[model samples]
Target: MNQFNRQHIGKRIAALRAAHGDSLRQAAARTGVSHTTVGRLEAGQFGTSLNSTLRKIAEGYGVTVEYLLTGRDPQHDFESSLRRLPPEERNRLYFASPVTRIRMLLQFLMAEYPAEFPLDRLAARLGMSPESLRRLVEGCDDRQFTPEEVRRLGEQLAKVTSIPLHWFLSGDSGELAAAIPPEMLGAYVRLIKKAAEAGVRPDLLEMAIDLLILKHREMPAGSQNGRRGG
Candidate 1:
């Protein structure tokens, strides 16, 4: 069935804006709608019926109207949203609630099998019926999960997908943070937060900094690696 839900659309709009670091006023400017209208849109204060104004909103968010309305093209839509948001924000959106984690997991699967074949393929991967997956996209929760449920789901998903279980549990990237000494994790994230302000990619920045440390350690003690070029 091809349909949209008011509140679900509103949440996607709001999440996209946050992902883009957009204020309501910025979103309004992009969409050529008033800030108040944009606010109402995020609040899902409209009917599920798609219209011109809604089209403008979708275009402004750099997503197709259909993507917002029907949860199609989730590869482009969800990837852009996740990539544009910083790690901390990504963590919140994915790990905010048990339901959010499930939805995020769905996006992960959709990225693999997006477009025409996603529904049946993804349903198989996640071990759910197609109707069940559709309910999830439509904001219905079959599990009605709590935190404990989220933990168990995270474990199950990690086993199936090989994604780190800690990602679904903790806000930090456990792999990279583990590569760094535990004592330095806080400082590393602080640096990353600062670098993010300057538009440096956090993962890249961490790796580059790690390489520098590795270079220093591999150099002989009191070697010219530490000396200033003359």
Candidate 2:
């Protein structure tokens, strides 16, 4: 029995197939299902438990299994909330595009201690050429990322920089700062206090300015935000 509603799944699969210009035969070949079975599936006549086959269809179309099944944008409904925000708030959220966020963290790290973080060593460790790393950083400039990519990159960068992931993905930085753990909040507060005592203003206005340069390439309303991985 199909635990998931079959009609919606079939409709979604059919839509994706059509969008990709794939015939039923083509999808059947890719998924190893018979052409008739593919056609039936597209018509909501049957369902399957073959996750690998489902994944093949999803990957071929660059969508997540959840999106494929429900015809919804990925991100657990956060993408929907994005549309409800005002234009400036939406712009601020988009400003922290994955690439831009990662580059900002990297630039801050390197500038704070050039000798401690060797660019060559870091590049080699990541198996990326220095030029490639440079390009990756520069790519943030005037660039945009899909929501899936943004979420993935935000998680990865958060792990690397020890920053809370929410800080990067949160629709608002002010609200995100308030949500940090108490211990983490104490650390930041203390750091700010120390900086003030030392006559060093720990202003991150420049970082915000850099983030502002990111061009928002958000998907249109009602468009699916695709996903990667299982």
Candidate 3:
């Protein structure tokens, strides 16, 4: 890629990393790479060795190297490769890959919906036994999900929770207005619930307001109440 394109890619990488709540240090810890290297990679300050850098990032983000490199669909090819391995070995590599985040989220959802969508039912959907699904969810920190599998899992999760698939796949939480902070989350939940009762989508305008509140919280104490010119 040209320098401009590379820089834009770096920015995208940074945005994704930030959105995932990861820091250069966390990525370094996971990838056995240095923090400085990650910082440089995210800034497009390094050239060449781009392939290796992209590989590390793809693995870290549970994306395909091809996706990182060319923004092409790499899910099918990666998933096909994953399925060819022996079951146990595949399990090991899958858990160790970067897409393990999806596994963690699945586990979180299972816990969050224990009564309504129990483990057995979820396993059936994934074409796995309860024990296997349990293992998959429990060991997600060590597992890597290919992008296709992640997309499939996101779709399944949407079906189970009555949420939209794009929300999960694209990492947009429509309920952020009411689902972010635990403190005032109940208030927003009630608002959304009221909207549901009224048969209207809770206006995302409320969510935009909530985001501004969150942004204010992120500011320094001195800046918190200070008005700034646009």
Query: TM-score for each prediction?
Result: 0.32, 0.37, 0.31
Minimal lDDT window, size 10, model 1: 170-179
Per-residue lDDT of model 1, residues 1-230, tens digit only:
23467778888888888999989899888888778877887787874444777778766766655566655654454456678886656533432554555567676666554653377865675566898778776677535656776676677555444456665675432345445544334555567668879999757976776885576457675563345232
> What lDDT does each candidate get?
0.64, 0.56, 0.57
Ranked by TM-score, the better of candidates 1 and 2 is 2
lDDT sort, best first: 1, 3, 2
Q: Supply every candidate's count of residue pairs whose N, Cα or C atoms clash at under 3 angstroms.
A: 0, 0, 6
Instruction: Output the TM-score of candidate 1.
Output: 0.32
Q: List the RMSD of every prediction in angstroms.
A: 14.3, 19.4, 20.1
What is candidate 2's lDDT per residue for 1-230, written digit by digit as tens?
Answer: 25577788888888887887888888777656667876777778865554565666665566656566655543434444456777555444432444555565556545543543467755664455787667766664424456676676666544333456765664333443434332234444455456557777335643432342232124332331331111
Backbone clash tally (model 1): 0
Query: Which lDDT value does model 2 have at 77?
Result: 42
Clashes of 2: 0
lDDT of 3 by residue, 1-230 (tens): 45236676677677767888888888787666578887887777775777677667766666644344444432443345457867544433321332353464466546544543478877886666787678777663332455777677767654443344554454232344333444444444455557657777445645654675677568785663354421
Task: Indicate whether candidate 1 or candidate 3 has the larger TM-score.
Answer: 1
